[model samples]
Structures are given as C-alpha cells and as structure tokens.
Target chain A: MSDYMKRSFLVALWFVFLTFPLMVVKVNTLKNTVEWRWMNMLWVAIGAFVLSLLWRWALERRQLKNKEAESGEDESTRLGFGQRLLVEPKLYKPVLAVLFVATIAFPLLFDIYQTNIMVLALVFVVLGLGLNVTVGLAGLLDLGYVAFFAVGAYTYGILNSFWGIGFWTSLPIGGLMGALFGIALGFPILRLRGDYLAIVTLGFGSIAKIVIENWEEVTNGAKGIAGIPRPGFFGADMSITSATTYTYYLMILMVIFTIFITNRLKDSRIGRAWMALREDEIACVAMGVDMAKTKLGAYAFGAFWAGLVGVIFAARNTYINPNSFTFMESALVLSIVVMGGMGSIVGVIIAALVLILMPEYLRAFSEYRMLMFGAIMVLMMIFRPEGLIANVRRKYRGHKVMTEDVNA
Target chain B: MPEITNKLLEVKGLTMDFGGLRAVDTVSLDVCTGEIVALIGPNGAGKTTFFNCVTGIYKPTRGDVLVHPPAKKSQRINGFKSNRVTTIGMARTFQNIRLFQNMTVLENVMIGRHCRTTTSILGAILRGAKTMRQEQETVNRSYDLLEKVDLFKYADEFAKNLPYGAQRRLEIARAMATDPFLLLLDEPAAGMNPQETRALDELIVRVRDTEKIAILLIEHDMKLVMNISDRIYVMEYGKEIAQGGPMDIRNNPKVIEAYLGEEADA
Candidate 1:
C-alpha cells in the first residue's frame, strides 16, 4: 500500500479504538446503577465499531476507485437490481417483510416471557407511525409527541377505573383526548420553526409527565394508576393469567389498523399536502393547500393513532404510571422513526422491533443496553442517516420548491 | 362545457408587505373569460407575490379578489370566506416547480383535485363505488394531462426523477387537474430551452382555447410573453408601471426603463 493508504488505515484503526473507550466509559457508568454485567459488552461494542468503520472505509475506498474508473469510463448505465435494492430500497417491503413479521410474531409465538417486550415494540411502532405523519411526511418535528401518548393512556385509565368504562369504549376517548391535546399542542407551536419547535415539543412532553405524576387525585401520583383492566374481545374478558394471548391478537388488530390508516393517509391528498408542506410551506400554500388545516390534520391524526395505542398499552398491562410514559419514551419512539427511515413504514416497524427487542435479547448485558442503544443511534446518524428506509419510495410526487431561477 | 361568462377573476389593489418591504403594492389586475393576460417583470419584480396574494397564500395586505363563476354555475361559493380564493375557481403554479417528490407523477395531479373530490373518509376506506369511479376518473384525467404535456411515459415515475423541464410541465398539469376556470402560472418558462419555450407557448394557447380557461401568466421570457399574451402588465418595485397590449408594453418608455434602467427612459 502507498504511504497515504497506510496513514488512512492507521487513522481508521485509531478512531475505532477511541470508540471502544467511549463505550467502556459509558458501560462503567451504567454498570454502577444496574449491577447487570456481561463480560463481552465492551468487546462487542468495540467489535461493532471496528466492523462498521472497516465496512465504511472499504466502501469509501471502492467509491474513490469507482470515481477514478468513471473518469475514464461510461457510468451512465442503469444500476442492477441488487445495487438498487441494497443502496436505495434496503427497506422495501419484500426485502424487509420477513424481519418485520418475525419481529411481530417472535414474542407471540415463541417467547411468552418476552410478550411485554413485544407490546412495548408494537407501542413504539404505533408512535413512530403517528410521528411519521407529522415529522416524516409533513416535516413537523414534535419532540413532545409522547405527551399525546401519555394523554391517551391516562385518559383511558382514569375513565375506565373511575367511570367503569370498558377497554373498547375507552379506546375512542383515549384517541380523542390524544387528538385534542395534539391539536392543543400544535396550535401553540404552529408559528415556531425548527429547533424552537423541537424545544417546545420537548417541554410539552415533560409537562405531561409532571401532570400525571403530581395529579394524585386523578392519577394516584407516582404510585400510578393500577388494575387498569384488559380488553375483552367479543364479551370475553382477558386476564393476565391467560399469558398475553388476548393482548397479542388485540395488538395485531391495532398494528393492522394503524398500518392501514397510515398507508391510506400516505396516498391521499391530505398526505400530499403534508409532504408539500414538508418540502416547502410557501410553495404548498401557493398551491392552494391550506397550511394551517393540513398541519392541524396531521397533528390530529397522528395523535389519534398514538392515543389508540396508549389505550391498548394501558389495557394490556392492566397498570400505568406517569413514569411509564416519560420523555425517554418519546425519545425512544422518535429514535425508531429516525432509525427505521423517517418515512418508510416497513423501516419504522423493523426499527421499532429491533430497538425494542435488542434490549430483551441483551438482558444479560442490561447495564450496557442503553449505552449500546445510544451508540447504535450515533453510528446510524453517521452512516445510514436516512434510517432503514430513508425516503426511498419508488415515485415521490411530493412537492419541492426549486430555488433556482425558473426563467433561466 | 357550460356557457362561459364574464369576470372569471378580479384582483383589486392587492398588496403584500414583509416588514415594510412592500412586495406587491396596490397591484390590481383581472382575467376575463378565456383570455391570456401576462404579468411580465424583471427579477424581484413581485409577480410571484401578486400570484400568492390572489391564491390566498398571503392574506393580501389590502385587496379584494372576486370570482364571478361561468353564469350557469350557481353561487356555490356564497357562504365561503373571500380570503379562501382557490376554493371558488382558481389554481396556480409556482415560479419554481413544486411536485411532491415521493409520489408518482399521476398521484401529484390527484392532489390538485382535492377541492373537487367529494370522497369522504368512509368512501375512501371502503372504496365506495362513487369514490372509486371518481378516483379512476381522476387517474384518467391525470394521464390525459400527462399525455398533453408529452409526459405520459413518465406517469408512473416518481416526480422527483423527472428532468427539470418535465417537472415544470408536471406542475402545470397538476394545477390544471384542479379543473380551474382561471390558472395562474408563475415563471412557467423559467428553465426551459428555446424549443421548450416555443412548445410551452403553443400549449398555453391550446389550454386557453380548448379548455376555455383564462390564464394569468407571470413570465420573464419577454419573447414568449409578447408572443402568447393578449394583454400585458409590467411591474417593478412592487408597482405596475404599465398595462396594455404587447405593443404598448414593449414601446412604453417607463417599461423600458424598469427593465433596462433609467437611461433607457431618458
């Protein structure tokens, strides 16, 4: 190898080494609290970093070589299927469906102990799909989306426990409450832009948690609301003694419903409005799309899905505390959207499952879990920043404003 | 088509102010039954702002825009608020092309039909017969529009992948899909080559003639504007300096000054 090449390899090796220490420091800090230690956590993190860096380096090197090759050769030929699938359509349904089905079915069919884990995964999927409408399609970043989820859960829990409402009846109320608050939250932040909007949303989510925690009369304070009854499908009540079967079917129903609604919205005029707004609000408005109405619609619809899921969560667990729906929960859901590929439904589903299930799979390395999660997210941001699907839809008819002179 | 009538659109004293920088100042214009009126201006001449104001994007600082439907159509717009201009009978394109990048070229046009489609949430969910028919018709109309734009082969393609000129054409098709009586095209010939511009001129003429739709076009292409327009309005620094037939606009000393600077008028 040439001198420059040797220097680059050493630099890559150095960067990989640096990441290991960072992981070690994080692992140590987390270990102080959780007391769950796996001997290989640090090694695995380091190995992943090295492998990722090497893969990236190899790709970069190949790209550079290709660039050189293309300088003397024709590069206009259409790419092969494998090239298209790997580079752009990595999150395409056919390629991703197997992993997604496995994720949904794994906890149900095989590991009963991890049923709660799947519940959480499915919850994030609902949340991601919810946020996807606002953030992915509409280009509205809501850091406080968890607030709506909390509202839905609490609304259902409080109504069911006090008013003796059934789980099914409470579902709508939860969705309504979520939509109401989503609208409520959206209105105040409508005029805000970018980071300012994000901050306000973050604050909104925190406020929801605080309200749930402090409102002892309604929510039972930090002790949280308990004995939140599970749903009875076809008048047959579900109990924990049944080992999560009823909830599984209910979750499947919800998953299908969320997917259906989201898909419909994605293809509809309203969906186009959202995308147009995302691309360029000024252009969208000029196209006769009512910006306020379209944005409000996204917020409302996203909240409804989140709220519905929240109700299911409360029902499935038969308990909920303010602690359960914290800012972290919101962050986790947002991360799923980001990791899955912001606008790809299948990507989001897989991302939610992988992130949710990874913790369970590494229960032995509990202390390093959050650290590893953070590392994966950071790595993803650096490398596969588009999330798993990354705006790779076959034909995007969404609005885009070309700033270049149209008269040119 | 029903008997075409007078006063398709009326804009009176439309103005826009972005923090005391008046973008469009007291710009009043009109498009009457099936006529092509051109808004010609230099760069930063506020033609787009005028378009935005008429489309209800910017609540005009001070203006009244009224649409008198083609007589046979009842006052279907009576109870509606005046500021919501497009719901009445107007549709517009941007100075820059804006097509939803993730959707198919066909789907992009369907979005323009939002105001007309009566498909309810239930209809959408169930794919009710009427809604399905409407959707099929919409798809067909989108195809027809693509074919007219000579972009039928690109119907299934993502709008983002289309070449620049094709994208501009797609935007026009999308705007037309709204079934508007009046179409506002902002800088429609901006990125087009001479051949494309010539074709666009012909297309614009055909659209006016065949569809019987009045067009208010904002174009910097002087040749195309002078060729296609029945009447022209020249504006500079947010104000209309000249308004008349192509010859009047071309010969006006003040219009020349606005474009070629003060020395030309002197």
Candidate 2:
C-alpha cells in the first residue's frame, strides 16, 4: 500500500480500537446478557478511514495556500466567499433587502413562539456585537461579559419592582448602568492581559451572580424577580401577541442601531485606535494612543449594548433570575462572535441566528445538539480560524488624483 | 556651533537597571533643532535602552530627559508615559517594526493622528459636521504622509502585506502623521538593501529639511549614518565612548577599537 493508504488504515484501526467499548459492545443488565455488535466496528473503521483521507487533503491544501500567501501574491483576490458577498454591494444589498422583508413579515406569518425565539436571537446579535468591541477589536479576553448583561437585567428588574418604573425609562438607564459597571470592572484589570484578564473577568462574572443570589433585599435572593411589565405604547396597553411583536420590532430596531453605530465607528479615529491597540499595545502607545482611555472606551461601549438588551430581555420574560445570567450564556454569545467573525457586524448577526435558531429548530436531534455544536466549532477552528467572515479593513480611494500640494 | 540654542531633546545621566543588571549607565546626549543625530554602538551597547529612557518607555533609575519645543517652554519629561511623550511632540518607530499588521496602511497612519484629533465616542457614532471635517482632514493628512514616503500606491494594503522596505517607510509615515517635532527611529536601515538605505538617507534629510523635524536614530548601517547624521554618539558597554562629527568619530581610536575590537600590543 502507498503511504497515504497505510496512514489511513492505521487511523481507522486506531479509531476502531478507541471506540470499541462505546460502539461495538452493549450489555443488557436487565436480561443479564452481553451483546457484541461487530458490524458497528466495521462502520466505524470505514468512517474513520474516509475522514482521515479528507483531513490530510485539507491540511495539504492549507499548507499550499499559506505558501502562496507568504510569496506576496495578490491577496485581495483570495477573499473568502462570505467576505465577497459583503464587499460586493450588488450581492449584499439585495440580500439585505430580502432579509429585511423577511424579518418584517416573520411575526405576521409565524406563531408567537417563533417570533419570541427570533427576539432571543436578536438579543444575542446585539450581545455578540458588544463583546466584539472588547474581545474582537480591543483584543481583550473578557470571560465575565455576562456580568454586564446581568447588571442590565437587574437594573430593569429592580427598578420596576421597587419604584414601579416602566421598561422604556429603564432601557437607557440599564445600558448606562452596564457601561458604568464596565468601567468599574475595567479599572481593576487594566494591567492584566490575555489569560490573566480572562481569569479575572470570569471571577467578576461569578461574583455578580453570587451577589444576586445572596442579596435578598434587593435582588429577591434566587427566588428571582417577576411580574416586570412589558414596554408601554404611549400609555396604551398592548395585547400579548401585539406586545411580542412590539418587542420583536424593538429588537430589530436595536440591532440596526447597533450596526449603524458600530459600522461608523469601525472606520473612525477611535475605532482605528482600538484596532491598533489590539494589534500591538506598545506600538499603539508609541503612536500616541492612550491605553487606558481606549481600553475603558471599549469596555464601556461593549457593555452598553448588553445592558440595553438586558432590559428588553427582562421585559420580554416578565421575569428573570440569576440562572439566566450564567457563564454558559456568556460562552454562547462569545462563540457567536468567534464563529461569525470578530469585528464583522454582519458575521455576528448571521452567527447569532444560526447558533440560536439551530437548537430550537433541531428538537428532533436535541440529544446531539451540543455534540454537533462542538464538532462544528472544532472543524471551523481547523479550517477557518478567522471565523465565518473575516473582517475586511476599510479602504480609502481617490489617492492618485490628489495633488502633492494637498497638505499645503 | 552657531550657539546650539534650539535644543530639541536633552538626556543627562540616564541610567536603567533591569533587576541586578544595569542595562544603560549614565548616557548623555542632545539633539538640536534641524539636526540629524545618530546613536551608534556595537551590539548590547545600550543605544536602544537610552532611546527608551528618552522616549519614556523606561523609567530611568537615574536621569533627566528634557525637551525644548521651538515656541514652548522647556519641560523635564523623564518617566512620563510613552503616549504622553508622543503627545508632547515626540514620536518613535520600533526596532522590530511594530506596525498594526491587520490594519490598512492608511488606517495605521490615521492611528498616529489619534492624539492630535479630538473626537468623542458620540462624535464618531454620530459623524457630525465638525467630526466629518476633522476625519476628512485626518485622511488627507495621513495620505499625504504616505505619499511623502512613496507608499501612497499601497494606501489600502494591510501594513503586514507590504514589502520589508515599504513597511519601514510606512513606519516613518505613521510617525510623521503624529506631527512630532522630534522623531526617534530605532534602526531605520537595519535590514534594508543598499538602494533602500540610500532612499532612507534621502527621506531622513527631506524630513529634517521640509518638515523641520529633528531626528535621533539608533542605527548599525555605518554608511547611512555617516551620510545623513549632523552629529554622532558612540556607545560601548552601556557607556558613551565618543561624541563628535562623523569624520571625528571615524578617525577616533577609541570608537574604532569599540567597533573593530582592540588591536594587539605589537
């Protein structure tokens, strides 16, 4: 056999050996008998053999592409499919228009259940974009990002329970509260970076949850707050279906606002500073970018969106507990940002929809949902570590037409 | 020496100690307005360490760094944050070419304009009339700097995608975007071909002549240093061994020994 065939055979045999107990052997304790399924072992070997061949082919192709990249060939022509879809307005504008129409028509056509799920997904879309500012643009590994979401939720929950405040009033307040907490968290960990920053932020997230769980007087102490009112419509009460629709549209508007601001900021001076800070802090500082201000700005801006969405989440649920603001929620939102594309707004939206909707729609395969999610993540990392859509830097044109006396 | 009154940067008795090892030991240097000062030394001669001290990258254990802007008061600037140093009209390029690899060349230079431009987060999001004007001005100025360095054609290319020489020139353009009165270049010609080095020599002179920015560079390329520098300082074993004109340093026995090794007694 050739070397490739031999390697594939060895891989197949190794997988068969590794999976022998799980796949090939079954014990029936009730019948006091053991059953051996040798055919399952055959299936495992065939699957592993084909997969190994494909894996080797992919690795070889990746190596060849990397060599070409290092040779300084035309890089723009190598834009990924998702990036091309975004770069070409003719492609994206129609797609966006279709998407816009679909979203508007979704609640009318689908049941309240589907609209609710979409609202949840939109919440994550905002959260992912917010985290993109800190983790994607600023290059800060924030593990406790859910703490800001919790702060926003609790801001609305507590305000409504105590003072009988409404949702609209608490929306901006919740966002600002999140920003305030973000800056507070940002101050202590300014010197920490990478894994250390992640650890500290993770601790902060756990602390926020524990504080809410214990602080009975303010946060209801794990019994959770309930009966938080839905948003008001100019003093007119909205029916349950209309209210869900209202919140759905509100979330859509929020996503658009977030995208608008983020898109503008990406090419602005402050945004460039953050990207530079992400690339190299030492060089950024040398270039006259204030490290502390830029870092705090990222944290605050990111938290603001989380907080805004948190208020809506509380109003939609009409109840919230510490259980909702867990580390898994943070991880899910982070995965959306990573799987979509860090610093790419469009990527985050698509990722949020797929990640959120897939679980809901795949009820038949619910048992293997997490398994499939993990596998997809691993495969994505192996093949496209830059995420589903790599963020393309903004390009300036008309430089050739400018005269040398432009500065003069 | 025409009175040497326009002293742009002055470092006196600067020393930096990393744990038990003294990396830089009492190195004093000065650059006046309109002068290209070169800091030359053998490897591990504490030249970059001194630059770090002067640029506020390191808090010198014992020293004073002062800058006298042309129309501003003299201020002692030792131990200031590096960003603060740049804000005070001093910008620097890295020894290892620390350009933001993923950002476009124009964006990298625009970052150099960060301190000079004033735009709040709201302003950026809103893009008001004033903010838009400032942004246009920033882009124009950054592109102008790129053109000056002959990298205007690659304005939209990522900084990492540029050739090595172009990357070096991009660094200069980015630093110039800060509109600094004094520019500190850490080995600008370290890895350039002779032709690129010659181009760099011309660029340095043009920057000094046209922009009127004073330059303090640490370089190993002897030819470029000799051709462009108005004055040269030689360092050995973390100490200043010689300070004079290029011709004087070329003929100095102590400098020659430090670079070429000490001659045999015979």
Global lDDT of each candidate: 0.77, 0.91
Clashes per prediction? 19, 0
- For model 2, report DockQ: 0.73
| lDDT, residue A138, candidate 1 | 88
Q: How much is B207 displaced in model 1, in angstroms? A: 0.9
lDDT for position B32 in model 1: 82
lDDT of 1 at B94: 77
Q: Candidate 2 on A96-125: residue-level lDDT in tens?
A: 899989989999999999999999999999
* Chain B structural similarity (TM-score) per candidate: 0.91, 0.97
Where does candidate 1 chain B have its weakest 10-residue lDDT segment?
B74-83
Chain B TM-score, structure 1? 0.91
DockQ of each: 0.18, 0.73
- Candidate 1 docks at the CAPRI level of incorrect
What lDDT does model 2 reach?
A: 0.91
List candidate 1 stretches off by more than 4 Å.
A1-5, A8-111, A233-241, A390-408, B1-5, B72-83, B262-266
State chain A's TM-score for model 2: 0.94
